[model samples]
Target: MPVEWVIDQIKAPDQSGAFSYASGAAPFCEIRLWPNRSLPARGFVFFIAATAVMLALPLIAVLGSPVWWGLLPFILGTLALTWFLLRKSYRDGAMEERLKLWSDRIEVTRIEPNQPETSWSANPYWLRLALHPNAGPVENYITLRGEDREIELGAFLSPDERTDLYNALESRLIAVQARK
Candidate 1:
């Protein structure tokens, strides 16, 4: 998960000590969520090296043979296809979602590789977060219900991450309610 950053806004310094939910978070918001990524810096380097080595073994054995020439194009094509697919997947996976929960309103920002960034908002009082562990196209499906429409969140996250996000959201909402 390539989650970018989080911003936490507190209600007030004095109020925080007296109340467990002192984060005037309800009347206002201070929550952010980001998507998870599977690959890391080291993994990418290892992956490319392994791919190259695996693809070169047979070619090396046939060096100087006519067969090597015959197989060259096919081997090169396979490597090219692999590289293209991995790059495409990485691009497609470059997606992120941010949720901001405030006392009066809820806002979400979604950023994708090719599409323009989008945002949505709803009343905090009317905001509802739902998680469908098995009912949607993806596992651990999660969606946010607002006044007029419902928006999905964490779709780019893994199952476990989605579940964790749900828990965190649930807690924030509860704290906001407690403050109100």
Candidate 2:
């Protein structure tokens, strides 16, 4: 399907209240200026730490034996896996930039390797945004829901951005509901 463009221009609060400009031109989908929350650096650090531990296992094991030869395959395998994971994460991040909004519909477009773009839509009136808090020491995911469908956005934004997006979404939902 053709991609629609949506732009959300967040304006400072006036005498009335904080208002957002949501506009869509032909062929352009809807855009919402969501608070941009980036993924935490700690998560990356943890991942790297975990990866380092795994990568060190074979080397440590080989230290006392002739099994150092095994390090070659392990090194190569870990490199490949790490590359794949990082690439997948980057692609997922890129796909989250486009969104669609309608009277009773919402759609999201994202990119993947073989599949560059993916789209999903739902009933806008009944749709809800769900914020799932991360357990332990990780950041949470902000999910938009409609019936059984859920889309996670703002995964790579900073904390401040996440709060802004959350507030913006709440305000938008209120505005949309009040119009009806």
Candidate 3:
């Protein structure tokens, strides 16, 4: 799970011993979400090195022959292409979603590589969180609707994670609404 609760203060009390629920502009909860990455930087380096070694193993037999020279360029090219494609995949996966829940409002911001950033915000009172199990592009799709606008949330998350996120969001929203 790549979801991180950056700031969780939904139940924090103020100096007066009251829930800080709509007392200020500060958000009660803030969360950041990103797609799970299996290959980290260290793993990537190791993988590339291992690939180079494996790809070079066949060259040992032809080391003193002209065949090695002929195969060297092709092997290097293949390795280069593999590295390039993996790097591109890493770049394409560079995206993040941030959700901030304030006393009176909820806001979501999406940051994607090589694309314009997008944001949405609305009053929590009028907001609704929806989870679609089978009718969406992905299973357990989650969306937030408010202020005459609707936005998808955690679309990159797995089905189970999306369901968990929906549950968490629903409960948190309910708690905030209760204070209103």
Candidate 4:
């Protein structure tokens, strides 16, 4: 079934907050948040270029002699390594969305292949949202944390969008916290 209570309006700035019930059909059922971060185009281009270079090495090495065919192993190895690195980088750039209820335990899914799942709960009265920033050499990610668990969001958002989302989340969190 469609979500019984859809979030129509979200407050800004705070990393965490509450969603108002648009239909009023049910008491607050669940809270959902998505943080996004975008992959650097330059990084992707670099990966592609590296892969192409690796794929061409065998042909290049074969130009001189029959023994040059031995370079096939090196080319295959390079291709495999490149694929692994690219997959890991893409997974790192993926955004994670979370849903939970204050009245019960929460479960967080990483949304990335081979990642572990998390579960936790917050004090019903003092539920708060938090943002954990990651400053990696190649990229950045924003993690959204609630009472017990957190998920990374904004992994695919542009810089401006990330800022806007952070603001929106911050404001919403403040408003919710002020309610009780």
The candidate that achieves the highest lDDT relative to the unseen native structure: 3
* Candidate 3 C-alpha lDDT tens digits along 91-115: 9889999999875778899999999
Candidate No. with top TM-score: 3
Per model, state how many residue pairs clash.
11, 19, 0, 24
Q: Candidate 2 on 1-180: residue-level lDDT in tens?
A: 122225543322232222212333221125543322254457766776687777777687668666777576777688668867765675554444566543334666665445656667766568787665663133656778877877776565665565666676666555544543
Models ranked on lDDT: 3, 1, 2, 4
* Clash count, candidate 2: 19
Q: Candidate 2: misplaced stretches above 4 Å? A: 1-6, 9-29, 32-94, 135-138
Candidate 1 lDDT trough over 10 residues, lowest sum: 12-21
Q: What is the Å distance of residue 146 in model 4 from its true position? A: 7.6
Worst 10 residues of 3 by lDDT: 12-21
Q: How do all models score by TM-score?
A: 0.80, 0.48, 0.90, 0.47
The global C-alpha lDDT for each of the candidates, from Candidate 1 onward, is 0.71, 0.56, 0.87, 0.49
TM-score preference between candidates 1 and 4, better one: 1
Query: How well does candidate 2 match the true structure in TM-score terms?
Result: 0.48
Model 4's alpha-carbon lDDT is 0.49
Worst 10 residues of 2 by lDDT: 12-21
